[model samples]
Target chain A: MILSEREEEWMTAYQNGDEDALERIYTLLKQPIYSFIFRCTRDEQLSIDIVQDTFVKLQRYKHHYNPKHGKLKSYLFQTAYRLMITKLNRRKKWRSLLPFLAPLQQSEELPHSDRMTIREAVARLPDIQRAVVLLFYYHDMPQEEIAQILGIPIGTVKSRLHAAIKKLKKELEGGYNESGSL
Target chain B: MSQDPFKQDRHLRTKLDEYHVDVPDFPMKPSRWIRFINLLASPAKDPLDPLISTPSGLILLKIAPIIGTAVVTLIQILMFL
Candidate 1:
């Protein structure tokens, strides 16, 4: 996750109070961070919020960023992932306390989503496993970098990816498509 | 569809590709800007907010008028003396 030269320059410029450099970094990093978060959370608003917070955090902690520490994009992904997990955890706690909110939360689903689609199957994965799958298959991230982002050991990341893939294989055995039934 | 793990991975990725997510562009300043505006648009604080905003402060506020009247009457009695 070492920074490329261009990212290093951006970080240096950002640390020098260059607002436009921060914007440039955001322009480069936003899509990847947003994609990872949206695919992980499956909530557009939540993803946007996390992406926005990630940039804000980057700006707030600009002085702490060193190219020697990691890649800029990985740092962004880690921030978004942690923010998402925290918010989602808080939400689950609230939902448990107020079960009436379950219906409201479920209202995000489509009305016609009866048959299990591939996306649904992925969504049904546990949060930990879903993160692994999305990071690996969707984002094409390697195990070591994912380990860095998830703050887990490389072995743990592999096991999670294996567990996720096994669960996905089981859920998607029937070859579900976006159109519902094959 | 395929028994090979690599092929299965590829197949899974392709299936996931079907779940297209489009990330929209948003300006960086709007969040901070909205927050500043919200702060500005919030209700004005009472001049005595510091005096009455807490329990002790509220008690002090409630007793101030009686204390002022007592002090004024005491000053009048002293003037008579």
Candidate 2:
């Protein structure tokens, strides 16, 4: 299991209404959840908000987690993902109302770079593909579990991963040699 | 430089690893419910705050006049009593 035994115990205790256990679990998993949201959203304050929301969500949905089905880490990531997606969708609607603001938003979103770095390439990927790449490569999530977290089929996961990898390769080819990318 | 896609994949992983994120310190961070309540009472933090720009906010804005009238009516009733 990606989660250690002690962490799992904390999760169990937390579910049982042990408030003290929450600090331990939050200390352990906060970084992972925050980074995952940050990579996906590229928004600092929004990432922070989503991470806190994920914890609050854990308190609300504690009884809903099943150890047999998945680890607590995955559960937190799934909650964070849903929360981020919901906020992103809401932001999208607002952005749509003022289409002219897109360019201004983009300019502020990324700093000027002489070349496209791997980070920029990853950030430039479509939301769905970027998510698959981050979850698979960064988090080391298996396709099946990723499918569960993302609420997509295994086949879709595979295809999205394939597409994301291909796009990453093309974008990073300057640094990538024939042997492999570095 | 013989072709090994797995090697390329690993390289890509290595490149991806370059993007490191720094996690902010975990204090006893307050729950999001508290944040939302604060946001509603306070000025908008982010200009593009999702709460202020959503249908929920729009509904509230639409009914502000009604709420204001109801509050005034309730205050008048209390004063009369």
Candidate 3:
């Protein structure tokens, strides 16, 4: 993610205790972060909560944002990604303990027009693969930046993307032959 | 199988364009700043907490032994005088 010079300035000002700069940074980033989390989690409330948590984390760790290290956008995404994974893991553990607490039916809330085969196939992917695909395709992030955000090798990002695309194609084409490959 | 994956990527991108997820309005929460200020203002329960909490304390910790050695040498020189 190539941040504009103005965005970088805002990040610098934010670290200098400029509240307005912080707000501008928040406004600039909230939607992209919200959309990414929403697409990944499929839960509106959880997405909003995670977005709030992401900004709170940004405020707490404002000094950590340095353009020299990486883009501020990637930093924000990394924080949200870690929080989302933790939340999902906790939810999974709870679901295992209480079998009767059914998972939220997110599909039923969507309108018919939004229900595309590709979206469904993407949702069916494992968490890491889904993140790789979304960051690569939806966010227009390069493989190298994706690797930096996810803390994986560039080669692993490429393979995960290829594997995810193959899985999506197979699922969308109705030939989902499970060969025990994740 | 004949379809190129790049073509599929274009198709997926088009499909993604058609769907719009509404972003909810969230007010900026400044509670984190308040918590940080509280941490600074509050008294430290552990003796090491203050040293670890602030940058100046960390610098003092690093130079304390050198300062102690210099003071001891100065006292010895004064005793010889």
Model 3 steric clash pairs: none
- Ten consecutive residues with minimal summed lDDT in candidate 3 chain A? A173-182
Model 3: residues >4 Å from true position, as ranges? A1-3, A100-116, A174-182, B1-9, B30-81
Model 3 sits at an interface RMSD, in angstroms, of 13.6
Q: State the lDDT of candidate 3 residue by residue for A130-165, as single tens digits.
A: 898888767877787899889899888888888988
Top candidate, metric lDDT:
2
Error of 3 at A147 (Å): 0.5
The TM-score of chain B in candidate 1 is 0.43
Q: How many angstroms is residue B48 displaced in model 1 relative to the true structure, after the best TM-score fit? A: 42
Docking quality (DockQ) of candidate 1: 0.10
User: Which is superior by TM-score, 1 or 2?
Assistant: 2
Interface RMSD of each: 10.7, 7.0, 13.6
- Clash totals in order: 0, 0, 0
Q: Write the per-residue lDDT of candidate 1 for residues A1-182, one digit (tens) a residue.
A: 33446877887888988878887888887887888887777766667778888877887788887778877777778888999989888767866775444223332453344455677787788888888778777676778788899999988887787788888767776655533553
Deviating ranges (above 4 Å) for candidate 2: A98-114, A175-182, B1-7, B26-28, B31-81
Q: How accurate is candidate 3 locally (lDDT)?
A: 0.75
Q: Please give the TM-score that candidate 3 achieves against the real structure.
A: 0.68
- Superposed on the true chain A, the predicted chain A of model 2 yields a TM-score of 0.86
Please report how far candidate 2 places residue A35 from its true position, in Å: 0.7
The local lDDT score (0 to 100) that residue B44 gets in candidate 1 is 36
DockQ by candidate, in order: 0.10, 0.14, 0.09
